[model samples]
Target: MSHAHDHDPTVPREALIAIAAVLLAVMGLAGAVRLGIVPQSANPELSRAAANVAPAQQRNLRFADREDGAVLVTDADTGETVKVIGFGEGGFARATMRRMAKRRMHEGIGPLPPFTLTRWQNGALSLSDPQTGETAEIHGFGADHSATFAEMLEGARS
Candidate 1:
């Protein structure tokens, strides 16, 4: 026995039309943002904070590899090779360099792209792959280290 109030379950036409209108409005807003017709920023404080950030400073050494299996650490500002860290069978420096190379390969970047070593204004040491937009922080702003990489950076500056 069916109850008198029983009927097909469905959304009301008014609700459906309201949903469609809201969806269309959202799409139009998204399209405007995508087309650069709408300004992304709405907060002046955030814009000021972004503008206040200090630029990254050039590091002492920039590392690049050669086809013949040589890791050349050079000056960050100048392209001059400060030292050549030979690619040995296995070592920390070699392993690190290999990881960077693998990341470049994964990103489908060419060898000619700039690989930068930067010391930010806050003194954090970082190795950056500009081509892939990947950055690895080597050490904290003022961390102490006596490793070969640290020594290399120091020597490059001198």
Candidate 2:
């Protein structure tokens, strides 16, 4: 038996257990992500509600569109609603472009299509059709009331 007897039984057991634990942790993390958990490490979480609002407050940002199914942005962690800007129809980019064009701010925002930034009646912000019945009040894009819109508007700017 050429060098075939050099294995340790205890080592295999320990390694197998360790691998199982790692696999579990990975699965849990992936599950969390799929369940609307944003990766703070990759996206860099926004700390405050007023991180990137416009000075005049003429426009607020929004990214909580249902079409962008993977994304789950909010004004605040406890925020039940978000401000919606550029909630375009069609595909994600097409919707954004259409909305931006409506506002007379057409064109891509540094390769990213313009997302519509519309104000809600109650004030919660959102990025979907106002008629869709999924809107909430947002103070405005980058308003003191919401941070998600602020970030989206900033990101969309050329």
Cα lDDT listed for each candidate: 0.62, 0.42
Candidate 2, after superposition: displacement of residue 47 in Å? 3.9
lDDT of 1 by residue, 58-128 (tens): 45445676798888777656677767876673266566656877898888875665666655455445666
lDDT of 1: 0.62
- For model 2, how many clashes? 24
Minimal lDDT window, size 10, model 1: 140-149
Q: What is candidate 2's TM-score against the reference?
A: 0.26
Q: Please name the candidate that would achieve the greatest lDDT relative to the true structure.
A: 1
Best-fitting candidate, scored by TM-score: 1
- TM-scores vs. true structure, each candidate: 0.47, 0.26
TM-score, cand. 1 vs. native: 0.47
lDDT of 2 by residue, 1-158 (tens): 59888876576787899999999999999888778684544321132233443223223323343564433333332333433443432244334434543443332223122233543333344443332222323444345435544444443322
Which runs of model 1 end up more than 4 angstroms from their true locations? 1-56, 59-69, 75-78, 140-158
